[model samples]
Target: MDEGPQFSLEDDGAGGNRLVLSGRYLVSTLGRTNQQLRAIDAPVSAVDLAGVTAIDTVGAWVASTLAQRHGAEITGAKERSLRLLEAVKIRESSGSVAPDRLPVWQRVPDHVGAMMRDLLRGMAGVVGFLGQIILAIGSVIRHPSRFRGRALVRQMELVGVSALPIVGLMSFLIGIVIAQQGAVQLAQFGAETLTVNLVGRITLRELGVLMTAIMVAGRSGSAFAAQIGTMKLTEEVDAMRTIGISPVEALVLPRILASVLMMPLLGAYAAVVAIIGGAVIGEVALGIPFLNFLERIKDVVPIHDLWVGMIKAPVFGLIIGLAGCYQGMQVEGDSEQVGKRTTQAVVSAIFMVIVIDAFFAVFFTEIGWS
Candidate 1:
């Protein structure tokens, strides 16, 4: 039968004692070894491991802890035992280490720097994505047979035909509100009749296309982002790429083309709806006859105004489609990212739509379209 692990102390004659260990040092003998170590009252000068015939990690931990607590040197350890003791010592030291704390003032600058880097990286991604879409467009132009007509028709129905009811209702309400407000203000100058001019010019030149674009951004734009992002999360996008299909051409181009083709029609329909709403409001509030209001619109609202809005509609559609699809392509990791990118797509598309409208307003004014 093997003897259990044991420990003893030796008086070194220099006012310090040496700890001596023997027997198999393992979990089975840990209690006995611990009791023996705790009974020693003298300050330990060193731990003598020469008599330790067998050992393991648990035993090494016990020896290392005692050596550290007493500030005693480890002595007489064989090469293998020495390595194990060193490992235990390192582990103990690492466990005792504390993380450095930063002051609030220092942390602010670090956070800001990280934000700036992230913003720059995001901008670069957008630019690269734009280039990819342009290349895909070029490829489609070169290979017209590769175009997906069914997908394009489906997207047109989604982006245009299905959205008509809400777009029409929204535009109608907006026009009524605009006419009411214009009537109230123009009545002060006995120019309540000019409300017809106000409604016609604004609806045909700006509000019709602008409002429709915003609606599409919120509806179709978010849908595109969520749909593509979900596909990405499920690795469907990756599968398309692996099978040698260009996701940009097959997935993105149809959406963009559909939006571009359908936007002018939607905007035209919205404009007519808004004019009808304005006419109703004018007849009820200002006692203006509907035929007289129609005559005023025909006489005052120019063809240029309608053309200006029509041109901006397709451009706004392109922006909405690109923004939605681009943000979708950026989705990574998980479902949370899909939701976040979808929100970003809607916000970015609306923002770009307004900014582009502002630029158009400025350009048209410079060229005397105003």
Candidate 2:
């Protein structure tokens, strides 16, 4: 008769991984059961399975269980050992388990709808802002004395002072680009000298003023929105009303009146810089004499073009200021909300300015005044 498979554990010394298992395993000869598993006494990197000979079904099950509980790094585990482990669902103790299924693609529509909802919320804020402007206008009309001269002047400075550098830079670069493009196309027709005409006419009539307004819309419009939105978020608007002060008189009025007054001046400033820039490019790239460039430019660009551009300035200022103030009133009392509305203010202001420019184009075209 053979003894059942089992083994006694060894004493693990210091500095080794030790494993202790109960019971003996494997039948070697009659009258004595052979050792099946040897207990690891030290830190073991591997277990020797060579000691395992003919394994009963229980022996296979024991091997598989040990492999799963510890590690299956046995040096002598052959196909039989692996097969037995597989049949019993034995796996490495450190093996990673992952989900059997992946998430569905239906999350896409939900994300898109969220984005659209945010856009609509921003638009509603703009509508509320327009209503506030009307209310402010009425209040201002009813109380003209409320217009503090010193504060109004400061407001004008806010709208105009910081705008000059950007206006000059953009207009100068735009003039250079126009001159370069004009020279290229005109050279094909042997009329490269006409770059003076192209630069002067385009800059004075449309580019200079439109570009100035757009810049202001981007810069000042966003400032207005962020400022107002932050105040709204902080409940400053409500505090003013509580103190018997009108937010319009205190905030919207000054900014709007400033924009209405100063953006035209700034536009005029931009136009002068643009013309000067065009003249510089006209002299170099187009090889046109400065004196001739100026003289010829006078004949090409009508003085009325300057007026047309200047007229668009106050309108742009209104759109920009209104958009900013409107967004401010819509602020949801968070930094993120303020930032979002500020961006909306800038985009809407720029969009409105472009729309107004289209109207100018039509008005000029219909009146037979290029």
Best by lDDT: 1
Looking at candidate 1, the ten consecutive residues that score lowest on lDDT are 89-98
State residue 198's C-alpha deviation in candidate 1, in Å: 0.8
Per-residue lDDT of candidate 2, residues 1-370 (tens digit): 4333444344346444433322333322312332234333234434445555555545556655555445534456557755765676654456458745434566677778899998898678667767776887787789888766677788777778877788889988888888888889999999987787788778777888788877877887888888888888788889999999888778888888888888788877776677677778878767777778778877877788877777777888888788887777778846999888888788888898899889988998798767
TM-score for each candidate, following the candidate numbering? 0.72, 0.67
Clashing pairs in 1: none
Best by TM-score: 1
Decoy 2 TM-score against native: 0.67
User: lDDT for each of the candidates?
Assistant: 0.90, 0.73
Q: Report the C-alpha lDDT of model 1 over 159-207, residue by residue, as the tens digit.
A: 9999999999999998899999999999999999899999999999899
